[model samples]
Every structure is written in C-alpha cells, then in structure tokens.
Target: MQQNSLKLNSDKTQLLLIGSKSTLTKTNNLTLNIDGISVSPSHQARNLGVIFDSTLSLEPHIRQLVKISFFHLRNIAKIRPSLTPPTAEKLIHPFVSSRLDYCNSLLYGISNTSMNKLQLVQNAAARLLTHTKSWHHITPVLKDLHWLPVSHRISYKILTLTYKALHQLVPPYLSELLSPYQPHRSLRSTSARLLFTPTSKLRSFGDRAFSRAAPKLWNSLPILIRDSDSITTFQSRLKTHLFSSAYP
Candidate 1:
C-alpha cells in the first residue's frame, strides 16, 4: 500500500473466517499475522454495510437489523398520530424500509426462518404507518403500500441487477456473468428468453451464489415478464405479479 501512495489502517481492518459451521468449528481459534501485526479472527465482520459471519449464517446481521428497525418503528408509532399518511410513509420508508432494503441482495438463499426475521420488521412498519392494531393482518396493508415482502424484496433487487446486466447497462464484470439463454429446440414464445441456471446441490455456499440464484429466479418468472420491452416495464409488471401472488 505504501508503494502505491496508500496506507493501511489497522484500526479499521478486520479479519473474518468464512466457511460452513463444521469447517469453522475445527479452526475456531485461527488467527492471522499481517505486516507482523497479529489479528484475531472475528465471528462477524461488516464491509460496505454487508455483514458476514464465520459460518456464513447472516443471523447476526439480521438480528441487528431487527433491533434497529424496531427502535425506529417505536418512534414512528409515537409520532404517527400527529402526521398525515404521506408524511408518515416518508419517514418510515427511509428509516425502516431503506434499512431493510439496502444491500439485501446478499441475503439470497437464506433460510425462510432467517428471512422471516426481517419480514416481521417490515410487517411492523406496515402496521405502524397505517395505525392498525397489533393483531391486524399485514397482507392487505403491504399490498396497499405496494411493498413486496422481505423474500420477494431480495429477489427484486437481484432481478433488477440481472436485468441491467442483460441489457449491457451495467459494468462488464457483471455482464460477463450472465448469458442469453438459447433453447435447444424451436420455441413458440418469440419473446421468451431465459438465463442459464447453474445446477448445484443444496446446503452449500455455491447454491447461494448469485450465479445460481439469479438464473433460478429469472427462469421462474412468466414468459411475458422475462421478455419485457424495457426495464421500467419489467419492474412495474414484476412488482404487480409479486404483490398479487403474495397477497392473493
């Protein structure tokens, strides 16, 4: 770093061991020495806001998100009585929803158990904004707000990036990972183009990769949506489809 006119900041540097639970347990005490500085392994580390754990569980990050979101939810609930619908929506969105949405693509392939942790926070936000009772159903409220649940929200982010990459709108590195799907036989739908889905077994890190998940989700979409005329149109139609299926 010094040779390149850059300096390493030990204060901000952290070393994390990433692997499966079984792998991490065998080397729990592992450490590293960089530039003669001894650095201990961290169970969890945050980089550019995404949190990664030694076991790659992401449980710690979701817990923190739930904690902070409820704090904002409580504050919003107290002040919601005084604010109009639009104003309450404005405040809760940036405070709560934005927190849930930021860098959420990393959450792909997380267990439903983990995904529900974040969904509960979103459910609370919906109820708070609408001044609904604690027991009130959140399905309708989310639909009215045009918000997708946490699981779909994560998929939405991934699909959006994939769409950009498909159109050559994103950087070359991202575009390189995606290829236009070619059928081995004649197809009836002229506009239906799919992404190649990589096959992998479950319960491994490779199964959770964007390369794998992106194509799986893309292929699951309806033919018309897969062949939308533009990104804007795709987004509009995609949200509607997700909203209807989730709420219906």
Candidate 2:
C-alpha cells in the first residue's frame, strides 16, 4: 500500500479470519496491530456486496439477504394489486432476484437450513407475483414462473462459471483452477468431457471450494451438456437439465 501511495484507513478497514468452526474457535477475540493501529477480527465482513462469516457458513449473509429481500417484497406487495403480473415480475427481478443471484455461486454447498431460508424468500416472491395462496404448493408456482429453486440456482451459477472457465472465457486465475481430465489410457469414459476433480481431505469446507466443487459439478453433468459448442447453448441446456430436476 505504501509503495502504491495508498493510505490505509484503519477505522474503515475490517479484519476477518476465515476457517472451519473449530479453527475459528481457537482464534476467538483475536486482534491485530498494524503500524500501531489496533484492529479486531470481525465476525462477518462484506466484500463485493457479499457477507462472509468467519466459519464461512454464510448464515449471516443469508439472514441479511432474507431481511432485505422481504423488505422489498413487502413494499412491492403494496402496489401489486395495481400492477400487472408482468410488471410486478419486472419489479421483483431488479429488487429481489438480482440480489439473490448476485455472487450466489459462492453459496454452493451451504447448510440445508441456510438454503431453505433462501428458498422461502423466493417462494414468497413467486407467491407475491402470482397471487397464489400460502396453502398452495410452491413448486408449481415456481415452475410456472420458470424459476429454478435456490439450490439449483446456486448450482446453475457454478456450472455456468465452470463452463466459462473450461472454455477460457473467464480469467486465467479461475480457469487455471480446473484441468481437463486425462486418463493413463483411453477408455469408454474418455469421451465424457469431464474435468479432473482433486481429492479433498477436508470434506466439510475444502470440498466446497471452487477447485473441488467446480469439477465435481462439471463431471456430474451429462456429456451432451459438457460438450456444448457455445456458452449460450451450454447455459440453455444446463438450465433445462436443472429445471427438470428441480420441478420433476
């Protein structure tokens, strides 16, 4: 920072330590001194509009998302009666859907409880748009809206990035994390268009990383989708595959 002539704003700067639960516990109440300025570790920190907790559980981020989404949902509900369904959907997309989808690829492999909370927000949004009662099943409403559930949406985002990375469309930093699978000898699975998945010792946290998750999701995809010739085609086929699984 000094070499770049950038001054550190100690008051605005936040220190966050990320690790598993047990590892975080060891660093409880930890603080740092930088250039005689004392900085304490924050339980959560915001970066690029995404909140990251020490444990990387993302529960705090989910709670914030739920709160903000419902706030917009309530405001939209006030004018829902006057606006047509299409107009309401447009409004919801910018206010709610964008927030849900923004940086959501980072949410892969989160706890089911956290995922469920997000699903409820999407369900409420769908219900608001369609005027569906709470008692009615949400799956059909979501399907009718052509919406993928929260979990599938996360998967969609990850798989899309993976596709881009594999095709050299993304930055080299991300693309380099993945490698084309090469076996010692050609076999029946050689044409599968799979990426090499590295073994992760820390299943709980390490497996959720992009290096592990990307290949796992990519390899699990059908060969047809994996062999897509273009980004547009890959996304279309990928959405269709996930939508079927989500609604079926």
Candidate 3:
C-alpha cells in the first residue's frame, strides 16, 4: 500500500510537470538530442535555462569541458571583475591556449554577446549560492559541463542553470568574500586549483530544497536574462520562437 501511494504521488508530479511544456523542458535531466531539432520547442520556448545531471546522455568529454569552462569564467570575473576588455583578455589569453576542449566551441559556438550572458549567469550563480549555504554540495556536479556536443544554446542554458543551482548550494559572495578560516596562502592555493585544474573534485549534495525553489526563481527572471544574440534582436525573436502556449 505504501509503495503504491509513492508511485501514485510520483506519477502525479510527473504529469503536472510535463503537462506544462515550459516547466517540463526546464528540468535538468537531459534527453539526448543528437540532432538540434528536438530542442526546437525548447529553443522557441525561450526557456533554455535548465541544467542537467551527468546521468544524461551527453558525452563525458563535453561534460568535462563545460565544467572547466564554467569555473574558469567564474574565476576570471571574480579575480578582477574590473579589468578592461583588452586587459581582461590579456589575463584571459593565457587560458585561451588551454588544452581544454572548449576553446574552439566558446570562440566559434557562443555568440558575441556572451559577456552579458556571463554576468547573468554570475547573478544566477550568486542567487543560487546564497540559498545553498555550502560549496561542497555543488562542486561535484559542476565538474560536468561541455560546449561541443551539448550545442551552443543547450550549453548556454545549462551553464546558466548550473550556476543558479550551485549558487543555491553556496553563496554569491563565496568567491568574493574570503573565509578567514583559511590562511591567505591556503585560500590562494584553493582558488588557483579550483580555477585551473580540470580534474579537481567539486563538492556534491543530495537535497530537494533546490527542486522546491528553482521553478519560482526561474519564473522570476526575464524570459531571457542575457543577450546571447542581441537584446532587442533576441527579444523579438524569442516571442516568435516560443509556441502559442508561451508566457512567463
């Protein structure tokens, strides 16, 4: 009887979730779409802000690249969030030659307007981290990201969601606000390793607090937070992009 009740509740939840396509598509469980067509409705839905678990069909290599790129971007922004474009690039240049796989994808696949996207992702990460209150829980899952096979749009949204999800684990000020608990050298070492190394372990957690909060949080953000293509351009395009069922 207890087993049946659990199954019944689970079925009802799935039905309620998928019944709303916009909500349905935002889930982190990636259903393989070797061809981009599967995401047509998602692309059009203009709600591309879903993260995925490694259990998804995505390849391991792409997952690794995505993880490396995510923290790298975060570290770059945090290191000197004030650096000028050219100077930032100069500091960024060394990493450009990284043997990491996404060099070509980030350059070729991501849109020119990604700076805004980065900011938005950062904001999302900040918000998510605030609620999470711990970094270890989020680190392990984040170690899995990729820009290649995941496709540009998919990677963009996935990264954004990942930031937001992990942010829920720790704090937005986490990267910025230093822990006095650690000595300066240890802090620097930890920062460098998290930023530079690809194989390092990020902390992980198993909690449903995120599940309860993410939908409301996502709904609160704009139809699109960043200008992957252009502010005005994507604004117009996303409307036509979504189905007749679309709404905030």
Candidate 4:
C-alpha cells in the first residue's frame, strides 16, 4: 500500500510541474472520476496551449521567427538583415537633418558620450545629396565630430565619399579644412605648402584632372617600390586628391 501511494505522489508531482489539470471526481491532491482515474484540472491544460502559441508567431516571411533569432545573433553578423526591409532601410539613414540638428544632438562636449556615430554618417550623406554646397558643413562632422573613415562604410560615408566625388573641386572653405593634413606645418605657410604636398588633393581641378594617372603608373613600379615609395606617394596623393580646393 505504501509503494502504491508513493507512485501516485510521484506522478502528481510530474503533472504539477507541467501545469496540467482536468475535471473528474476529486481529492485535495487530485481531480478524479467516479471511475476513479485522477487527472489534472481543465484550466491548466488550456493555459499550456496558450503559452506555446505566444512563443511563436505564424507571420509570413517568418518575420517574428527571424527577429527573435537575430536579436541574440547581432553579434555574429549584420543581423539587421533579419529585420523587415523597411525597418532595415530606415536604420541605415542618418538620424539628423541639418548642421544645427547635428550640433544640438550629436556634438556633446566629450566624444565618448555619443552613440549613433554610424547613423550620423548616413544622415549626413543624405543631406549632402541635396546640398554639396554644404560639404563645408558636413566634412568636419565626419572628421572631428562624427568620426567615420570610409566611402565603403555606407552609401554616403562623409569624407571619403565626398573625396571620391569632388576631389580638388571641394570648396575653399572645405579645402582650408584639408590644410592641417598638408605636408608643411602651418596654415599661413600652406599657400605654396601645396607644392610641398604634391599629394595634396586640395589643388586646382585642372591640375588634378589628369590625377587618375597614378593608378595606371602604379603597376609599372617594382613590388618593393610599391611597399615603400608607393605608400608614401599614395598617402601624399590621397591627401591632395581628397581635400584639394582648386576644382570646379
């Protein structure tokens, strides 16, 4: 009799863990029938069904399924892909609208406090699309405030993208910004300092017009020369190409 009672208690514990219930005859420990098969209560069984449904959505594209799985997986990839198309595109756009918006929101006194550096680049690029005249306004935000380093970084990454598009043609106000990177030391000396930094992209567009010649000449140079002279020349040239002001 004790062994049979132990078995009944163990079975009841298991059913309780699963939140099972049924209607039948009764004891304080178990619901039963007149036939005497004790069972769980009805409400418990229905609750379990609801729990399963809540855990998974039946949406097309398995949208919920992708989102839930990717939430934990963003570390491994641009799991943003799992987000719906509209949401993914929106996140890629920069959060701010104008220089004033950037100043108010993104330009905290200290650098580390900022978030959304990447988003700033995207939004800045979009603004540039309408106003290349405002490249002066946008470049510092990329170089000093927002701090990004790619044309490939996003569709319209700030400096490098603007560099590829305009080169020496970027405005004088913007060209002045390039002066710090010029080869000689001071801004006042930087006038003919452009001569020192032959690599300075901040030149007259006419001088830079044939500038694409370097790539073609690059292959003719020796491999060791490339690693040394090529790098030096490239760096100088890159500075000149990207930041030069003497273009139309």
* lDDT of each residue in 22-127, candidate 2, tens digit only: 7877875678887689999888999988999888888888999999999999999999999999899999999999999999988988888899999999999999
Model 1 TM-score? 0.91
lDDT for each of the candidates? 0.84, 0.91, 0.34, 0.32
Candidate 1: Cα lDDT at 65 = 90
lDDT of 4: 0.32
Score every model by TM-score: 0.91, 0.96, 0.20, 0.20
Question: Among all windows of ten consecutive residues in candidate 4, which has the lowest summed lDDT?
Answer: 52-61
Q: Per-residue lDDT tens digits of candidate 3, residues 33-149?
A: 322323212222111222223222122333444455566656775855466545654544355223232322222223334333333333334323233344344332222211122
How does model 3 score by TM-score?
Answer: 0.20
lDDT of 4 by residue, 27-86 (tens): 255544322555553322122112111111112112322343233233322544365544
User: RMSD of model 1, in Å?
Assistant: 2.1
lDDT of 1 by residue, 61-144 (tens): 899899999998888888788999999999988999999999898898888898989999998888888877878778888888
Error of 3 at 92 (Å): 11
Q: Could you tell which candidate, 1 or 2, scores higher by TM-score?
A: 2
**lDDT, residue 239, candidate 4:** 42
Error of 1 at 76 (Å): 1.6
What are the candidates' C-alpha RMSDs?
2.1, 1.3, 22.1, 25.9
